[model samples]
Target: MSPEISVSTNEHKVLGACPHDCPDTCSMVITVRDGIAVKVQGNAEHPATAGALCTKVSRYTERSYHPERMLHPLRRTGPKGSGQFEQVTWDEALSDIAARLQAIAARDPQAIQPYSYAGTMGRVQGEGMAARFFNQLGAARLDRTICASAGAEALTQTLGHKVGMRVEFFAESQLILIWGSNAIASSVHFWRHVQTAKRNGAKVICIDPRRSETAEKCHQHIALLPGTDAALALGLMHELIVNDWLDHDYIARHTLGWDALRTRALEWTPERTAEVCGITVEEVQGLARDYGQSARAGQATAIRMNYGLQRVRGGGNAVRAIACLPALVGAWRQRAGGVLLSSSGYVPVQAAALERPELLAGRTPRTINMSTIGDDLLRPASPEFGPAIEALIVYNSNPVAVAPESAKVVQGFARDDLFTVVLEHFQTDTADYADYVLPATTQLEHWDVHSSYGHTDILLNRPSIAPLGQARSNAQIFRDLAHHMGYTDPVFAESDESLCRTAFGDQVDFDLLLTRGHAPLPVPEAPFADGGFPTPSGKCEFFSARLAARGDDGLPNHVPNFEPAGADPRYPLAMISPPARNFLNSTFVNVQSLRSIEGEPLVEMHASDAAARQIADGDVVRVFNGRGTHECVARVCERARPGVVNGLGIWWRKLGRDGTNVNELTSQRLTDMGRAPTFYDCAVEVVRV
Candidate 1:
């Protein structure tokens, strides 16, 4: 919808969208006064946003106008990682960067890698032009799997896409399983729906290793061991089968390979599942009873899953197992039933048209997984490895603080021979090592369109103010670089507004987005209610033939973590680094107000573990494993379950006690199905420092 701008002298409000890596891609109203954005608020008319904004995003004006906001390009004047630079003109920075990249491309374009993720979820700013630039250069393809890949691939294998029940329907669910998610911290909008259901006498259960804020408020909290979600899921299936609480007709008509899955599920009795999950048999049986009884009573049952549970070795199989639950109880028949990990597939994004991958001219470059950058960055050039990464263009992500095995990641970024250019709004940990730093425009000063994973709305962001200082949009920077490199493609000249229009082609109404600020897709209220899943056979697959063709197990099963709890006496405790409540990955860590709210990096441990290590609340502790060690304050609290420590993280490495974060102890090992990092599949030992 066109922004309802009531022009009064020099003040007006411009409709925009939050450009952060959050599930809630909120519709925002940037209140501008005399060409300055004075306020940012959620759009009251957007049903999903409901006029509410997260604390981090509500203070966006503070971020954009902060004294430290990057306003010009810079060239490194000191040693890499020294955080020393001299301001330079945009012409000088782009020319130098383009020349270096062109020289690297002359040898092998594949050696120049683009490192980016959901820094800005906008199609235009995120990858619209950047992807075109990289495709034209034939740079090494980045398998952007730092988040959600394991669960996304699992959904594809099981239900054919990352499609799910509508988010609004959760408000009407009678039984809700808050699986692997801390909705209060990460998905606040979804939590609103769950709260509505709670007020309506719905029962909510939180299943996670840590007693998260959401878990504390739920009717029940089952703190199972990390990476044992598949075991618990199978246990629920066992109870459902034994009690005959399943919809046999739905299972027979809307699912495939049920006999094989049932056989495997029956093997996981409550006793075996409890042992594997480090929970009581009664907890397992009780959860199954709640879910089964709700379904048998013809009440709406739903599952809201998040990425926290998929940062393990068996993450994909765990997702597949949980995704199979709704089909067993015929939950899809109701609008408020079924499960949702992501709603991205419901929107038809014209990625190929927007990115223009045909610019590659049929060249198949080697792909590098972003999750394993700790190892991949240090790999030597070989026939197998193709070429050592010569130039890295970092945008929208901070790898030094967020990627696994930070010690190795630091070593890779500190290489003197590697040419690095970072497009950023501030001097992030990754930017500290860059040869050049280019200032990128904030969401308030850019034109972009967004697709969300949490809802089915397409949001449009219009520039409320002109570019601040010498800042440029990410797309404009790439366009300038393309010009300097002498690339003469018409697509390179497309404006950001034009790129936004091309993002969805005819699938979404661009005119409606321009006028209303947001538009919803025409998706069914209950998409899979009639057994017409988007799978090959038009039904949910209990056993994925696609996996069988790839020589993997056809049926979902519990695969233990690489470093299971109690697997090694030396590192007996399990650790999970969930995002700090006030921060999203490493984005808001540098914001003063938010940082004040977070205070400092801290690790949560149960009293027993703290006592054993001679640690007390507020005492500095060393969390170390085979990989490396990180220092942080310890909080002996109930939030951390027994034998598990919750490291509130994504804090900037420089802010930590020992110049490292929890990723210092995480591994570069990939998961079972997706080549994603196992950030949570880690074992550690703690000691007072």
Candidate 2:
């Protein structure tokens, strides 16, 4: 393609996609001038993004050209975590890493572990070549279950699929429930659809522990206690059944275990549920009444289910209980009435081709859960546990700031024996502890494909600008490593274009995808309207025998978390750490603009709770528990529940007053069904410092 300049002198436009850890997967149009990227905006041609990018991504040029960006490979010159390194050539770095990994794999394959998450999220850079190399080396397999696994598992058990209502159909809804999600901040593109739905006479309701940005904008906010959403949902079910509001026909024909679910729900009375959830009995009954009326009146109601609810010990069961609500009310019969967990499955990618798991040659490497990184890092080598983690190759994640039990993770990183290799665009909190830090290209300088979890659009990205300095894409780096290691696998030889085309498969046209920014994936008009589920029973399993076989309750019921909701003598305050608006995990926390917009990280508690502790607003406070302690300014408001306190996550350790992060207070305990980390099931007490 020729360089097409705009009316402005020396200005050219290049197409790409935002590669942040977001569900939007927004297509971007970058403005380039004289070999430099000057601006970035959302592609108007894209259906989901619709010409509007989020606040954090609008300043892409600032982050891409930031002075602090890592522009070359470097080897540690001082002690670990000292952020002191000397420059090295790519060949030298790759050859050294390959030789070390080969030596480690010869002794025990499980000795090396590759750590990453949605930091890139692009199909190729996210998993493609890295997967091939790891599988070929028989390194420890990482279970990427840090974020949405538990909620996805619960939704799959109830709906038989993780796919949800088409986001374009949100405007057809008469009532929209934003449950445990602050779409306005996390998924700004989808928030536009909700705004349109509101304009179309949809009543918006937000259910969360804190009054988030979305809750503030919605017509109603149901602030419940943390980890008590299951009790509230079951109470609504009891009202739907006892008050004769349930669709009997829908239950009899399309659902199984109606009697069992009814019996279980009946045990949760509105009063009891209200007490558990810290809401009034009338509020619980009101939600049930409104939902029943909407169903009876043929008005569609949509539930936007987010991952926050499934971050507790009872999180899986909580999701199961909530997902069963739409079926009882016959909401799935309407156009957009069903619960929308995630739209990722709506667009299928050819994963077999991209990952090339055949590289492992039928050798199944030991699987390690990402949530238990701290535990695995600290564990000693043994015959039962395989070899202890000797080499830690980090990318697309900052576990030091984001992982649970952060103090323990730091301790593991401090080990002199651990050989840490980090690929990053900046010297992040985690990179400070690395033995070698390799510079990585920004999204604008990479070629990859992206699919949205909030919409069914598959978008393609092309390199908008040259990679700054000596930075390379993750795929390029891995390919270099494979060549240095003398690996002859054909998978490593595959080009990025070939891999992208392979991921699209024969079903999609690659040329057409490049012409247009995105294309909608083919799917049924009404996924569950005819009541044919993919489950064994060919119907929605209200009482999942699959779950029962796994030693869990078949019926959807409330399960208690590790921390009791009631006030305790030791730790009276419940800690709820959620993502902040200006940053995605630890991604943009280092950016000066975003950091200034977000201000300082602080602890938010109810005014009543603050009074009890004799802590005033803006007072520097120390929040502590058995796990660890952290200090921050206090923010007292009605937004937080009386016994609950909240904090924004993924702040750098250096920025905090006590040199600790929120994850220092989080637990490594797993959820009931999906084994996901129970991050929100934590307790702490805050006092004026």
Candidate 3:
């Protein structure tokens, strides 16, 4: 349903969607006055958004109109990483960039790489035109595994896709497990549903390494060690089996390889799980009891898993184990049951049509994992590494700040030989090292389309104002670059509005989106209720034969963190770098209001650890490991557990106290299954500076 738009001679409302990397994908109404966007608010009519917006998104107007917003193309005048640039005309910038890219393509198109991820989750602006450009150029394929790849791959292995129960159904759930998610900070709208479920006498449990705000409000919190989620899941399964909580009929009819999974789960006793997860045996037993009783009583029990848990060594296995729980007691039988890591798989996005990969003309270039860009960038061309990276086109992401092992990333970006171009609204840490910085428009000045991962809604964004100054949308920037490069592909001529329509084509009701601003997909209330799981067997597979064929374990099992707590003599603590509540990664770190709210970068340590290190609250401290040292204020509080420190992060490297953020201590090591970054599985120690 669409909210009513009020219009006058001088003012009117335009419908759009929040384009940030968020699950809500909130439907927004832009109040425009005389061709200028005056205000932005959530559409009350959108069920998932529920007329509410997070602090960062609510202040989007400030971001769009910030004083430092890049309004013109800039050419770097000083050395790389010097943050020196001179304004240039769009023609000069595009022509120079195109010429450089063409020169690199002439040698080897694989030398040119396009780096981007979720700066705008909009289909049209994100990869619609940009992908076409890269494919046509036969540039190196980027394996975008920075964030959700591990969990997404796990979901695909276990659930056949990243599908899940409808998020709105959580309100009717009798029990909710907010696993590895700080719902209050990252998923505000989903927290609303949990609050509603709480009001209705439902029990809530939070499973996370950190004692997040959501954990504080939950009925129970299991502060387990990071990367131990699979063990905990197995412990719960053991309890379900030993206590006779199984749904025998569901298991027999709708599951595959249950016997093997049962055997593996049975081996994990409560004591063993407690030791591995670094929690009390009582905590494990109590949580298992709660979950089993809820399922046995035929009440709805839901799990809201987020990407945070999957940013570890064994993240994929953890997701696989947790995904098997709903089927253990037939939780999918109820609309309010089952688990939701992502609802994205339910939406049938026409990715091939949108990206036009056929433009590659049968060329298969080398793939580069974004997580290991630090190492990849420094690697010379070889038999396996292929061509050395010569040109980098960055949009939507700031790798120098967000990528792990920032020291290496910085070293690679500082190479005078590397030609780099950035499209941004501000001079980010990465942009500071750019050969050219092209101005990119904000969501308020773009035509785009979005599909939500929190809800099954396809939302459309209509530009409310013209691009400010000389800024342009990401799609427009790519289209112009394609033209300058002498590309004759007709697809490059498509307008932003036409790209938005092409995003879904006939698969979705484009007419409905045009009228209502949002349209829900025809997904069922209980999609897997009758055991149609979209898997090869048409049922939940406890053991994936496909994985077995690939020589990996078919059944999910606990894989310990590469940097386990107390394993290193010098770095006895495990560090997890979660995003600051006021910022989404590094997006709003430059916003004065949001940055003021976040204060300075912080590393939260338990009182015991603080005392041992002679560090006091608010004391300047150095958090160090083998990789690098990060300087930040130490926050000694109950929010942190013993042996674990929380380094709230994604602060720009330039904004940090010592010109280094949390990523300075993070490694470039990848996860077990998806080859994604192991951001959380880090070992570190804190001491007074």
Candidate 4:
């Protein structure tokens, strides 16, 4: 169990960013000889990973020196969610969290919030200094709408814009539609360009209710029935409008509402969407005739997408009904068709790469939903939600095995009424509910800068070692917590080469990705002149008057709902976890060549429902309900389908802290554009004890 050691070529390779939550932000290089990093790869002039890299990022130099990483800071002397710390000294853990956050901002500056997500999505971890220490303590705002904000708020309320499409025309696609995503266990370099567009002839398919390995190496897989994918995508837009294969001059020249999307796609027929989509009436009419004949050969058919189907429950109208399938077949006028959705828009060979912190200049900070932040901190003692979340800070997150009620976020970080800090590198499940843990680094020991989730290529990480203990870099702990809370504007005049020249803002060769670590993005062979469409009636809306003042039904819709999961007729199967050990959310479960390809927390059933509950394969089982239970092992299977139950997500439970964490039987039931249900309805039953 000791493989990583590599380091040669006169070392000093240095380059960075693999920060993680990956989208293919690869770029890296690392090497770093004596100072450390050791060996890393993929940067062949970046442009959305040209030199390609995988196997959990060329083994990110064995998570720097992972032996359960996390080096200094500590402090919890057994109590605040007791994973029992002790270490201390970064000046006694920043003078004990700056004397309890300056006595909670000397009482009320919105009593501090500061939590974070993507566990490092990067843009210098969103230009650190923790947004100037949460606006010098005005705090509270932290709600990354619990996972891809319901598909980037339904593609920014129907394509006013958000990130999508661009990974170099995914090999001139001719038909790809994956949905509820599984791109070979979470975007393995966007399934290597959909297996190089199915080795050139194209046509991938997939969908999902579980059969995955990208639906067993796709050719056409379906599965269906987990929040019934907006009823099989409005019954494939009602078989692309009862077979006339509606493109009506690209929906009457560019599109807007088109008779309210043909009156809500004529109440989706095909036997009423194969009766609420359990699937098949000829597999929803052959996936709406292979996705409306994927750009009728004249072009467009790319779909690389992933955000794990916006974590379910209408997931922002299932990401505006799967990004309105390349504007219903014009496939965004081809270049390999459309919808990669974000590899940080592929970076500036031309320009624009997803900004808008409202356009940043401060002030929009009211957030909360990071999956109901441990039920808004265990219901502030139930006085109908008020005070009590006293202090939280955490960064490069881990709301206990990826939040969504993971046992009321481990009882609101094992309450004594919450204090938590985290900023980790492992010891995570939210650093076993910290009260101050700190450490950090890894990705070969930090220097960071990233962006990509399928490809645009924003790299530059460069640490490759040293500092494995008094660990640093979340931009030097938000610039030493903004010089210990004194606040210095110019947004604390940031650097890492000026946050890579403000992530190439309005580019004009914004350092051409610092000497080409990865650049290419303009995609203009006429990237739209006549087919305009940028929403507010400029076209391509499919009925979205800004989600018609938010009540929905503004077309681009698809509703089948589901995720209730607890009517307990002794638990009639239904559970699916996904995100298995290429270890994003649990930092390579203590990396050891990726925990020997996913270890522990089993369950996965199917073998005739595990031989009708006689279980077996490593049997231990439990899975329970009322709100929580977990003991795991199970794994029997027929490629999962029967009654269902599977597991692979975060898994940090190390022995009874409200037992078996599967977010204590998840289902905080969100997603109208907030997302966090993690697909497959939740009911449970499987027992073997």
Candidate 5:
């Protein structure tokens, strides 16, 4: 263990990719001296990434060397949820996890649910391998499609497929509508492209309930009410139809359900749209005409929307409403036109996830929502639902902190019936709830592939240095766990190289592709070159018969559903938890610089709202509903809409330790199919604490 092996300065250089909770997943290079990562820089040669790293990820080396990181595995010796654990060796930790998991499997394999979210979007690791392993083991299906699936389902219902155009398409787009998405704060590189498109004379329009940073740069702003996006979209379509601006020939030739759509849209004229959508009629008319009559000769006018992430209630219809825009104008027929719910390609995780039938071949039992993990543990219909969930394996997420109604998730862990296992570098909110905390190496200590949701390129991730301490990559841990579980199949027998090849399958040779940092799929040299479609109907359905058949009725049906967010006139304002540019969930809250500048968690309000409440900037205030209580500093900022309040999500209970989590108030109610929460419009009241 001596420092006998003297290495050159160049030997310290390491190559890796950013493992952020973002779609950009930019490739990076890290220079390590001794055991610590020093200089962090972008890898210029990385494909798709353009060697770009965001401010949050650029200083990741600081996160690696963060003083608060947990170095060794810990075993909770005290009562569950007591935040007490004793440091343990790797052998004890691994053996304990294996033995404990085996006991749970012996009792009921379905009890050991692997819960994870969009911490790492790559397929080879995170939930990809983990799900495959558990599926084979006949475990519970953790259907955590909480973030993107609602939009995907809506798009699939209307468009018959869920896919976005190439990132390069932004360069060709003549008109851009950023709806409920702040690309500049959430995606710095893509925002640069928006600026580029604007310079090229492509008009930009931002439609959001809040006048976000993206809205600030737009030609016009549609500050509609939360959950009202669909109404406005339908109204806009009505405007297009009234003015004869729609591509009628395109609709007649390549789409169905036009009559139904027209009928439904007529019900949403500008007057009705103004009432429901809460935007001015003039703004609605101008926004509709600007996009419907684009000068771009392409088949589609480019609109890069975030889908329905901002919905508080009526989330699914919100997705259905906005997604219908492209087809009305035949935007998909053009090069720079199409709805971008997600830029990560369809059939993600490649064919390995599809071809591997080892886990899901036979009939699997019940499925549970990711947003409702607490209910799954507490109210399983199975005979032993309460006592069966003895082991829970978590990777790439801090669900106890990130999931809606996270306080309940912690309470579920407090049950002796629920055993928690978390793989992470730090004792995250989820980790502290675990019986055993597994040491998961940072991206700086591992190798993997990057599948960006913002761009088309398949990025290659190279390990910058050796695993710090005894920490291992999630893939390595799963591979080892599979070995311990006595899975001798040829599929499980594959090495990282073989597994990655299986992951990529015949599509691309991973090792060769990794050398260049990425491999981009070839888009049609020209948009809509030939007549082809994936659905049974050989064309895009202007009005989806499938949706109509499925009883969705295809015209973005506007109906009120039971939602967690209901107004109490006493609490006149709605609380919105918007994405923070400086942080992703609770991951970067431990970092010094980002958290330092963000300061303590703050409840931001419009100046008018603040004045009405007689609240001023820097005032400590307590916000509460029937659900829970949270106290934070208040800032009078116009960023929050007049009647709406904005609070950043998952600041951590330990940081302010007095419930900084927004989930303390968010309800676990979800969509039937997509299970995504209507988080934007939850009602709450605030007062000086």
Candidate 6:
């Protein structure tokens, strides 16, 4: 391993963006010396990142030039899951992949599935080129709904658009409600505004099942049972309506179906909701009173909602119900009063053009939701479901560690008939099972365009340094594969620079983006200030006819989740898996520095639960459900609620006790809407190992 050091006068800086799965797509400047990246720091000019980088990204140089990073293509020399491979030239690898893909296409092109997610936020390397290649081959469409899809769709239906309140408006808020999000860990840039809002006399409140780091720092933390967010939100609505605290004028002017929503809210009384949510009736009333009175007093309130509340059975409905709060209080009229669901809608990138979905060759391929990758991998082909997947090309994701039903996913990966290919920078747990592990370039060596979902900044990632070895960006890899497979579509030959230019519409100047590092979209400073929603009725849909047509609840309503009922003796505790502070998914967990900082993968249990199981704080415990089991060190404390436990996200099987990943105990059941994975709606039992 080489240490990153400044070369005095020879060191130069290049502007880019952090290409992680985070909402805060931070603008960055990489320090390069002698064609090697020496350091990574946030671009001071970018408002979202300010000038400081997060703990994980600050060590970008180490990750780029890590000794264990795969630098060349390799073919399997041992059995699957053995992590043994022999170096192969790019020519040999591409030829073999092309031949196999040709064979697969002859029988059924839909048998080829491309697995990916937000591994890199780059416009070209992340999604564009590969999507074009897959579309041309008429491959099965990967439904890419593993995260944010449910919330995005639900909010889109209610608010008519997914764009939330402006990030800059948080400082002007008088009340900040951080719901189901750990801003400190996931969205650090946004957390700065929260801190400033708190300093400016705004009351900060956090609502989460676990007392997370962000929760501990907030002025108030309301710990509720997991999957009960909808119930609590409805209870707040009930209090607001029963007490006549709603903004009837705003509702009449800027919304539709208010009567239906009001009727639904009245069904969940404070006492009933409190009992269901495991909170006191007084607490419920107090929350409604504070939010309602604060709004009526001309004090603006902001709700920062994230994906944590939407990984359950009623995930989409929960988001829709919570998103209606701002409208109920007439929050949209104020700069900082509306709900912030996501900033994704701010950038109008021509994704369909970049992906060239017209290349599907008139074959309406089967769509497979990514959340059910475990089931998809194991299930045999049937007449109803088309052909079984024969070849899986994985890039920008580690499904084995991050996907639900880890045991089943691993079992499917071990199938002898499956031909698996992985493109990665490191030998992740998923890579360990790949038949071909192709080396991939780090962000420093790639060209990409990034648009943040947390902020309205569009940034460019330039090649600060040359490719380290034979490594290639995902875009280049797909281009090479397409050429060898006899596809001469002009779209495959499109340059990364061209893709970046096409990411935004005419509002952006591509030349200026390269020079300035980042540029803000020409959107209104206060979007939705006048209540011109983009819905069918040009108003917020308090009752959505689209949902009703789909046989879903027309009004914002609470639907019960899959938490175990009647205090089942087999699985008594609910488990919530959240992102670790130091790692993004499973990306940085292998870095020695980050691994040391994160210490070990442990199960955090409440003191009472630990005591009942006769397990001490440091005791090794087994967490199991009917799905599967996992073992880890126990951290018994009050951080987690008595009936609930917490397991940090995406630890490799080898790193955990008894070689078990937390996802092993999680089910792959799809949510009622959005076909999202119900990761947080699981029941497990903890016992001494």
Most accurate candidate by lDDT: 1
Q: TM-score of model 6 relative to the true fold?
A: 0.98
Per-residue lDDT of 43-162 in model 2, one digit per residue for the tens? 887878889999899998999999999999999999888889999999889889889988998998788999999998888888988888888888999998899889888878987867
Counted clashes in each candidate structure: 5, 0, 0, 20, 7, 0
- The ten-residue window of minimal lDDT in model 5 covers 1-10
Where's the lowest-lDDT run of ten residues in candidate 3? 1-10
Q: Summarize candidate 4's per-residue lDDT along 1-689 as a digit string, tens digits.
A: 00123446545665565666766666666666657655688766555565667777787667667677778888677765557887867877876677777777777545567777776776665534566556555666765766566666676565565655666567667688777677666666677777887888887888777787778888878876566676677777878877766556776787677676667877888887786766669988887887776566565666665666566666577667667756766777766676755534334421122222322346444557777776777765334444567778778777677777677777777777567677877776667668888886655654445656565445555445667768886767766765666655555556545655565565535455545544445545424325664557666676677666867667766554554333357777778777674767665666766766776667688788788778888888888766767777887765577655776666566633334656677767776655555544577787888
As for candidate 3, its clashing pairs are none
Measured against the true structure, the TM-scores of the candidates, in listed sequence, are 0.99, 0.98, 0.99, 0.34, 0.93, 0.98
Candidate 5 versus truth, CA RMSD in Å, comes to 3.6
The C-alpha local distance difference test score for the whole of candidate 1 amounts to: 0.94
Q: Model 2, clash count?
A: 0
| Global local distance difference test of model 6 | 0.87
C-alpha RMSD of each candidate structure in angstroms: 0.8, 1.5, 1.0, 22.8, 3.6, 2.4
TM-score pick, better of 3 and 4 = 3
Clashing residue pairs in candidate 2 are none
Better of 1 and 4 by lDDT: 1
Tens-digit lDDT string for candidate 1 (530-603): 89999998999999999999999989999999999888999999999999999999998888999999999999
| Alpha-carbon runs more than 4 Å astray in model 3 | 1-6
